[model samples]
Target: MDVTQVLRMNGGDGDYSYSNNSLLQRKVISMTKPIIEEALTKLYCAMNFPKTLVMADLGCSSGPNTLLVASEIIKSIDKIRLELGHDKPPEIQLYLNDLPNNDFNTIFHSVSTLQKIITNPSCYFCGVPGSFYTRLFLNKSIYFVHSSYSLMWLSQVPEMAISNKRNIYMSKTSPPSVIRAYYEQFQRDFSTFLKCRAEEMVSGGRMVLTLLGRQSDDPCSKECCYIWDLLAETLNDMVVEGLIDEEKLDSFNIPQYTPSHNEINNEVKKDGSFIVDHLEVSEVKWDACTGYNHNLSEKDTQGYNMGKCMRAVAEPLVLNHFGESVVEEVFTRYTNVIKNRMSIEDTKLVNVTVSMTRKG
Candidate 1:
């Protein structure tokens, strides 16, 4: 199947929209706010308050986080202008980018609200639809770039990944070949990303990228795919229940990679377009965004909360692969699997924050 054509966060504000299930992503964005503000602050100070601030947020899905981030950026710029007592803040030209199928209508609807929130009346918002692996704007047009929890997705599933049977992501049990395939895909995708941004950004422009990544250098570490492993087991259960064909399950592998610091730094060095200013690896609990519910059992709470987050981000790809009928069964099964593992207190996902500056 064509991964690019099918990959999207569930659209709209309905039950299945990524707008509803994106608590985890929103948490990650909140976690990185200070870093984002710091990066943009440094850029403004370094550039001596350029007259026009051109910024882009790649893979910006339609939701609260979308405008929240852009609004935060505009707010920062206005704050800097106030602190420095400049005659005026730069004209903020903001670009929100995502795939063609993203729920852009939802985002565009908030343009006026976003403008009203910004301290500066000059902030302008525009939605650019396309993949980030290619050029999305003119050369040196952007002065700052931000992407959150999005770079880990590969442009396409690797042909070699078909060997990772019955699993939707890389796991410890995956063969050496399967692991290498994932690493190579990440390398290619990230390198290409740097190349594109290098041309699109000004010489001193700053970029901050937050990816779901791991602390360990081992690509096979459970840190990378343990939750996915739980989901895989649920799929197996469905197959046993005659709800799904085992053959159908084997063909699906999610095109995502959780890279380690070493892998990310390696690609940045090879790309030679940016100097890495900061790289931090932090841990976030699996239930960080899943608030406690007194009405349900621990199992149900864990299952339902995690299920919503997973279903929101995963429904599009899963729906395309398994079709409409099985969507309910698969995620319901996935939730039960989460509930079964409620005793594992150490479950957390690693978040990587990398900030860089474009080289001359």
Candidate 2:
């Protein structure tokens, strides 16, 4: 599968669309706001107050959270300008980037809504469609960059010599060779991503990246593997019941990897283009809302809610592999699996947030 063409969140504002079911992603954006503010503040001071600020939001899936991020950045910069008593506000050029298949229409159509929230006439928006793995901006053109919940997706699924055997991602049963293959693929993709960004960003430009990661060094840890394990389990059950082909189940693998902090740091140091400012790992509840309350509810609908969330991100891939006939049934069984698992024990996803500065 072409990761650039096939890997995208379900678009539009329907009930199962990413725009509606992206509460989890939206929550992630909120969690990283402080990191973004800190990076922007430092960049503003270090750059001697440039008249124009060029920034890009990579992997900006079509959703309310897309503009929400832009609004937050504009608000923070506006606040900083006012505090510093700048007579002229800087013109902000934000490039919202994603794959070509992304619903750019929805994003462009929502500009008025963003205007209602932040009526900054100086702020301008543009849509750049392509893979972030390749260069999207001119050399030394960008002043700041932010990406949330995107880098976890590799450029493509690793080419494995041996079949992963019914598992859609790394698991305890996966062989050492399989694990090595996944890690090596990430190393290449991430290094290329860094090289491209290093060329695009100006010296001392700041970047804030937040992505799903594992707390332990083990790639098969529950923090990163459980979700896909449950998904594979559901598919296995379907195969047993003759609902899906056994060979197909054995062949399917997700083009995603959750790296540990050590792994990420190694890549950054190896790339030799950026200096790490801050790196942290935080836990977010699987179905937790973005409010003061942190408790997981026992609501019966939580299972379906989580199912929809997963569907929003994974449906397109599933449809491409298994056909649309089995999409609903697959997620239905997956939801029941999540509900049962939640009843037994609370589950959480680990998120890694990192801030970096381009080396001068």
Candidate 3:
């Protein structure tokens, strides 16, 4: 699906307005800042001489978190300058990239707000809007690349998997053919992404990417939760109730692209463009319950709203089979299901961040 088509189908900016709320965005920024800082330090160490550095945040959505990455990079550069006792700061260029349909208005406004707070004279900022899976940066030009909560989205799912005879992904049981198709597509997209980055990044440059991932090597294992199923079922329910077209529900399929750690490593190794430096997986716990209800205690509401808001933003893709009028209702049902599931004490989500360095 085209990014712009998806955004337009969901009411564009109106559907995405909630993403800019400060309270919701802080959670993402807090989780992501340290990862970016560590990557920047490594990149700085790898640089042979001080020159203008180009950094891009691929798939950076419209929110405070987008600018937070830029701010953290600038701060790390300043820290390096201070430690080296240099009179002038290092020249830096920052690129904030997302799909063409992203809320650039909010992003530009956030950039304006950030400019007032950042006093560095050598920093330059620009927005590069496009799909990362296709092409993002100029060839052999980027010095550092960072993408979080992106890359997991494939350009599109394979056609064979959606056929009626197969119907593998739609089934509740873990179908081997379906799982293999998904893995193959992920490998293709990820390899393309790495090859493109390999062409764009300078030798010895560093890249850090973080996204929602599963821990299992087995493709059919339940360890990886397919979130689209929940949304699909929700839309299916609406169809049964005559709220949506059954044919639309039948025709729609979730866009596939979640790779296990082993899958990612194998693809990276096969590409032979980047050396894997760090691979870490952390189980992130989120309170989906606190988001829909403001009556919950502030202390209990520790960034659950951010996850909820992300779910809301992604609901369009999940509910694309349904009519636009039922979009909100479908998301409400999905959120309620998530909240109920999260009520269990052991419920949590897993997030993985992988860092790679360009081979010289």
Candidate 4:
């Protein structure tokens, strides 16, 4: 599918109440703030002089997480200014960017709520709508760049792999060819993303990125907390039910790039532009105590209530495959499967957060 179609497929003002919940994302924001703040301090110290700082958050989806990141940057700058006792700190130009179809209205509303705290009229806020794989800012302008839970979505898979009709991504068994194709596309998009950002960032600028990743090499293996097997099983059931065409299934992929720490280090080295300053993988766990609690263990009525929370991501993909008419039934069966599985013990949702920074 083309970019426009892909956006349309994923676009909608569904019940994204969970995505906006601050409580759940707060933990993540708090955990990542120290690392980002440290990077900023190092960058400023290296410059050895006060200067205008331009920061951009690539793929900043409309949610509390976006604002949380922006607030962290502002606070860090404030702390630095106080330490040096500067009468006036350098200006801050903050850019929030995402796909063109993102909910800019919600994002703007969130920004407005912060107007009281971000009192400086010199502090600028702008919305940049575009793909991060391509250019998003002017050359030699940005001082810091950060992205979270983004980057894993590639622009598109390799064309050759799609044309081969190998069904590498979705077959009765594991398909290494499909896995390799996905990796190649990730590498290309990631490389382009770095190059584009490099052009916009000053020579001494720093970048901190966090995204979903895996530490294993097995295509079907488990890592951190993401269970590909469960997801595959869910999709396979749909295929068997004739709700979606098996051929079309291979046409689209999640495009998640779960690179190992070493692989990521190597990619940075190959780029010959950014120096790897910090690379660490940590487990991000989601549990019942989190916001918008959804699981199979809930009673049928309670589970349905929680299942409504998942429509944001599921509805689009399901609608694209099986007409919109089947959404209710599809979701019903899907949720039922979860409820059934919950009877078993030891099931949890987990993700890996890979944090990296560029040389300043």
Number of the top candidate by lDDT?
A: 2
Q: What's the alpha carbon RMSD for model 3?
A: 3.4
lDDT of 2 by residue, 1-360 (tens): 888889999998897888888887888899889999999999999999999999999999898989889999999998888888887889999999999999898999998789778846888899999999999999999999999999999999999989999899999999888999999999999999999999999999999999899889899999999989999999999999999999999889999999999899999999999999999999888766322223545565666677788988999999999999999999999989987886677888999988999999
lDDT of 1 by residue, 98-125 (tens): 9999889999987878777677888888
Give the TM-score (vs. native) of candidate 1. Answer: 0.96
The per-prediction CA RMSD against the true structure, in angstroms, equals 1.6, 2.4, 3.4, 3.8
Off by over 4 Å in 4: 3-14, 21-26, 119-121, 160-172, 224-229, 292-310, 336-360
Task: Give the lDDT of residue 127 in candidate 1.
Answer: 91
TM-score, structure 2 vs. true: 0.97
lDDT of 3 by residue, 237-309 (tens): 7777987677766656555555667777888899999999888776555543244446666543433453356
List runs of model 3 lying over 4 Å from the truth. 7-29, 161-174, 220-223, 288-307, 318-320
* Model 4, span 282-305: residue lDDT tens: 654333323434543335533344
Clashing pairs in 3: none
User: What value of lDDT does candidate 4 attain over all alpha carbons?
Assistant: 0.63
Model 3 gets an lDDT of 0.67
